[model samples]
Structures are given as C-alpha cells and as structure tokens.
Target: MTPPHATPVGPDLPMPFTHAGVDQLVSIWLAQLDVIRDLAEELTAEQWAAASPCPGWSAGDVVAHVLALESELHGAPLTDHEPDWAALPHITSDFGRLTERAVDWYRTKGQDVVVAELIEITAWRRDDLAHAWNADSDPNEVVTGPLGLELPRERLIRTRILDTWVHEQDIRTAIGIPGGLRSDAAWVCAGQFAFGLPYVWGKKAAAPIGATLDLTVTGPGVSFERLVQINENGRAEFIERTATPATVSLTLDWPTYAAASAGRLNSDSTGALVANSCRGDDQLAARLMPALAVTP
Candidate 1:
C-alpha cells in the first residue's frame, strides 16, 4: 500500500488495491488450507498423482510444491532454494523425506533451528499482508519480490490469495471437490491477476499490429487500473498500447483464470472472459496464458 515501485501506462487500467482486497486475499489463504484438508479426506495416493492444470505436474507435484513451501516456511535450511529440492530425488520417497526434513527444520528456528520451534509458519507468513493495502498512496511503483519484478505489496497479496485459492481449486477439481470457486476469495483471487495481465506479459510481442483492446470483468467489483505493453519495445510507449493491449482482462472463473495465469489454459477453454474485447488484437492476455496456466 505504499507508493508502487513505478508506473507508466501500458494499457487502460485501474488502481491496484483496496481494503476489500485484503479480505479477499485472506479468504483465499484460509480457503486454500481448508480445501487441501478436504483433499486429504477425499483423495488417496493414486489420486494424488492425477494430472493437474500445470502441464507436467501431477496432484502429487502440487502437494509437493505446497508442502515444500510450507517446509521452507518452517525455516528449512536450503543449500539452494533455486532449483527446489522437490526436483532432486528420482524416486518419490527421497523427495518426500528431504522436504520433510525441511519442514522439521522449521519446528526449531532458534532451538537447533529444526524441531524445537514447532511454530505454524503459515500463520506467520499471513501476517505479512495485514497492512498491505492500508495505504491510499496516489502513485504506486512496481517493486520486486524474492524472484521477479515486484508488484506493489498490495497487488502482490492479491496474486498470492489468487494463487492459493486457484491451486486449491485445481486440487479439489482433481479429487472431485464440488462447488469450486464458491467463495469471495475466488472472485478477488482471480480478478487480482486479471487486472494486472499487462504487467506480467510485458515482454511478449502482440499479434494485432494496431488495435486498442480491453479486458473488463463480466461480474462485479469496482475497477482497478494497471498498464500493458502493446507494441514492440523502444518505440513510443503510448503508440504501442494503441496498437494493441499488452494487457487484457481475465474474466473466467477462479480455476480457469488461475490455470491461464499459470500458462496452462488455451484460449478455447477460457469462455466469456474477454467477452467484449477485440480478440485478435489482445495478444498480451493469451501470450501470458502459459505462465498463469501452471505453477512456475
């Protein structure tokens, strides 16, 4: 909620955060755990390996990713967090146990830093966004996260919420959890990324050479703005967006939007999402589809 890292318009958009945004994110965060619990109740080892929205990953990989992150949360000492240990062992057994060691490490952050701490790191991580959107800063800049370019903290929280909720749905969908995307978390979780499609797809080339496009959501929620890159880089920025929307609206449900953001959903599968936009002209959204379609 402080000033965003930077801003120069790429597409026609809205402000990134609001108070409701926090609630939406929190809802998704909590819902992720609840749904994962449901998955545990309904699924088995065989089912865990079922394919997920993520192209190469299965339900097991998804679980491994979540559990691995939790393991990190508990302060597991990583020789290198880069290529996560999830990819280490050829067999699943070693993979599971090594990460379990990561989890055990968190239990004792100070007392040997492994078993004695015994703290629930998820709750602690949740606290990072408590006041994220508390500001009404007039001009926000894009900040960097641990990895890529950083979004405003507030927007970042929304994406996190969106990520948790959407992946939860992916797991649920794989295991036959009914009524996916039923909560407020689904709307904000999905919408948060939809609004910022332009920023994430900044480097891609647009299909439409000279066209204006927009990605307005079909349902409710006041508009928030962000920009996109439309034309080739190094040309005048405004002229570029006028040629095409480097940014486009994401209008599908929580599951599809999440999958699309992860780079999994093809355009055919995303229904009613860009219902009003110029399809051929909005290459940014689709170009970004690969990353959003899976968990990277």
Candidate 2:
C-alpha cells in the first residue's frame, strides 16, 4: 500500500509511483539485493555471527533467510527439515517455522558457505525474475509471494524490495555499520511501510470514528507528513486538510520509524520507545504505539 502523498526525497531516489511498472520495481529490488550482497562480502566472521535486530536471528541467519526466500522464488525446492521448536522460542508461528527450516539448515554451514550460497542463489533469482517479468506484464496479475500470500506482481515485487532493504538494515544494525539509509530502496521501503499507518490506526489501534492522527516522519532519505482520519464508516484514510485539530500526533526519525513499523522496536533486546515523540491524546498514542507494527 503506497501512501497517496508519501514522496521520497533525495537525488536519484525512485519514488514508488502508482503507475510504476514491474520493470521499475524489479530494478529497485535488484538494487537492494546488490546492497546486501556487497555488504555480506565484506563482513568479518564475528560480524556474521553477530545478533541482528530480528529476534533469534544472527546476522548470518538473516542473510540465510533472504537466501532461502529468493531461492524458493527461483524454483529451488524447500529444504526438507524441521527445526527444534522448543529450542526456538522466537519462532512462535507456523510461518516462522517454515522460514526457519531453511535458515537453520544454513546455520550448520560455515560463514563462507553461507555467503557463497547467498551469492549464488541471489544471482539465480535475479536472472529468473528478469525472465519472469517485464514492463508489459500485468501488474495486477496475482502471484504467490513469500509465505504463500497471493499478491499482484507489482505488489509482490514491492514487498520484496521492502523486505530486502529491511533485512539489510538489520544486518547493518548488528554489525554497527549503519548505512544505505538514503538509497533508492530505502525510499521505497519508507513509503511502503508508511502506507500501513491507516491500518495501524483503524484496525490495530481501533481509534474511534472521527478521530484524527498526525504522523510526521523526518527522513534524510524520504520525508512526509500524514494525516489519518477515522471516517464515519469506521475506516481510516488520509485527509488533505481538516478543520479540527488532530486527536494525536507522533514524530519519528526515518530509521526509528522503519524499525517500529517493522516490529523491530518491540524487540526485548533492542527496542527503543524513546526514539519517538508523541503528543495530544496520551492514551490513544500509547495504544497506537504497540499497534504501529503492521507486518507479521
């Protein structure tokens, strides 16, 4: 869901325009994958083993997860293995176990092997995706995406771009090499995640009808201000302007906003609620904070 007014600002940053074709989206996804591959190639063994922001996933594990998904998308068979559920308390859902099977398989291999496998798999995926999709392909054609979700091709590719970029940030955070925040992929991810604010407010937070929320994201990569209003039908939608003051307002930096939107800010190990500033309805803001994470 790309927000109507969310515009990514920076030189050469590609905005996820509503009319963007599959080719443009694929280009963004490929760029994000290149960033991850380059970063992985430079990682030290210690950094590879470092714990990422994803609970129970090391930096290498995160890479393996990405490799696992792309490999599946490229027609590679799933690894026939089941992880020890009791030992993996962080894997609380069926999808977690499904993804963990492949990640855990790679965990037994050495760092060099993991990196090499990622490089190989992603290379294959790049070629496969290029052949599979083109600018004229139907963007609305439903196709299977990660976790077996059926989505339009354009949306699936956009989701891939978002996931890859987020994992890249996870790796960077783990290794203390924070960067790529201003990349083309970062702007895409910013808009993609920010698009879920209405869902976060209406469905997750259950804000009362007619209530309005103002969300301001300060970004070096992509900056935007969103005004979400719950309508008479109990649905939230962005409004251009309103006469009444917002019921609540929250401001966050780009990185912090990304982390929170991806549910990383809820991590017991690295969560930082202090990174955000809230005003107006305190109770409503508190409710909205936990519900901010739109992704599972």
Candidate 3:
C-alpha cells in the first residue's frame, strides 16, 4: 500500500484544477498571499529594500509587482507613470519597463504604504476568485493571460499559482526568511515543472529514441518522481510506468529544481544542487541544463 502522505504521479493523480476543481488553484494562490502578508507584516524597512533573487527587483519591488498584477486582474487601472525605457539596460521589453516603473513608484511610497497595499489587494483578489469560480463559471473557458494570449481559465490559475509561489520564495531568499517549502503552493509550483519535461527532453535535450530520463524531487512536504521517454515518433512523452531502465537519473530538492526551471538560478548554483548519473551520456546531461529552464 502507498504511504498515507504520498501524492501519486500519473493517471491516478487528479488533474490539477479538475477533480478537486478550480478551488484547488485558488486555495494555493491564497495560501501564498498569506505567506507574503505575514512576511510583509514582519519585514523591517531595511529588509524590504534589499535586492531579491530576481535581478533588478528588491523585495519591496516584488511585492509591488504582485500588487500591480492583482490590480490589473481586478480591472483597476495601472498608475499613469511612463518610465524612460532607454535608460534601463536590464529591461529588455516594453512590459519589463512597465513593471519596473510600478516597482519604482512603490519604492518611493516607503515600506508601510507598499505592505498595506499588498494586504488590501491580495484580500480583494481572494474574494474575486471565490466569486468568479462559483456560479457556473467554466474552468476551461479561454481567458487572457499576462502575455495577452487566450488560455484555459484553469491553466491560467495554475500559472498564477506557480508565479506567486516563486516570487514568495524570491522574497524569502532576499530577506533571509526561508520557510514555505512544505506548503501546497510549493508543490503546485513543482508540479508545473513536470509539464515542461516533454519539451526539455525531446526538443531541447534531443534524447535518442527509446532513451528514458528520470527525475526525483524531494522537499519537506512533497516528493515526486517523473519519467520521460523518447518514442518511435521522435517525440518525448511522460510515462506512468516504464520498465526500461533510465539512461539518466537526476536527484534534487524541489526548491533548487523550481529555481532552475524558472531560470532564476544560475548554472553553477544548479550544478551544485543536482546529484546525477548521466550513465555514459555526459554530453546529454550537460544538454539538460539549458532545457531545465522552461519559464521566461
């Protein structure tokens, strides 16, 4: 029998936002908001100003970005502040510059103002999600994502959960307050990484036909194993169970894997965290590094 706490992978596992419904996604998002709120409540002004793991983003800036996104989701207009994009070398696109301006604006407001805004906006968002997902809303209905593409509403929720949890970790890392590893939000973030493995294995890594790769991720409250195999059709697919031995086996904790996949962790940091056996395919293992970064 499986252990009582085990989260089984494969077809037996409930599809995210399907069996448990959209409420699962909403709950994870809310939990992350709570984490941010608590951290905000405790943070000193000095802590807020400290730079986060995300380049060019201080801890306070990260919170401001979250507030801006939530405000947009709630149909609140962004502040009419235009930043000179040419002066900002770190900002590559119009969107990046837009967010930078929001962060800069919040930074000028001081710690109290920004923290209070986070609390208020997140509370409002929680209520909005509760009402929206109720009353005959279709989880699969197409919704506009941050990138301006239509995605299934459930898929959007999953993306939000991943993004929020990652930012929370970024804040924690910045302020030296690291404790969300056991939460449902963390698992949700980690689960989303599995969705990118097919692209990583087939397109990025270019695994040989019939080669299998196995990844085992461990964390405080969750542990999961994922397997990907290249098929005769020259495509990679996740298998529920595979009798064939894996050509490469990788072991890493969830946070490291999450950071690497999000492109937040450098290759040196990622290499330090991963314990792997390439099984005579060292070149293939090296190829896996770039593939690990699926988030933009």
Clashes of each: 41, 0, 0
- Encode model 2's per-residue lDDT on 235-254: one tens digit a residue: 99877655778899887888
In candidate 1, what residue range of length 10 has the lowest lDDT sum?
110-119
Decreasing TM-score order of the candidates: 2, 3, 1
Model 2 alpha-carbon drift over 4 Å, by segment = 1-16, 267-276
Error of 1 at 212 (Å): 1.9
lDDT of 3 by residue, 1-296 (tens): 11234553442353233343677667777778777888878888788888898887889888888877777787776677766667657788666776687777776788898888888988898888888775356888998765355899878887888888888888888998877776777666766787788899889889899877887766555567788889899889887656666877776676777777888877776555443523436667777866798776
| Candidate number of the best TM-score | 2
Count backbone clashes in candidate 2: 0
lDDT of 1 by residue, 16-97 (tens): 3334544544545555655554554455666665777654455655554454454443345453323334544533554445
Candidate 1, which segments miss by more than 4 Å at Cα? 1-17, 20-28, 79-156, 200-210, 216-254, 266-295
Q: What is the lDDT of residue 242 in candidate 2?
A: 58
TM-score of model number 3: 0.88
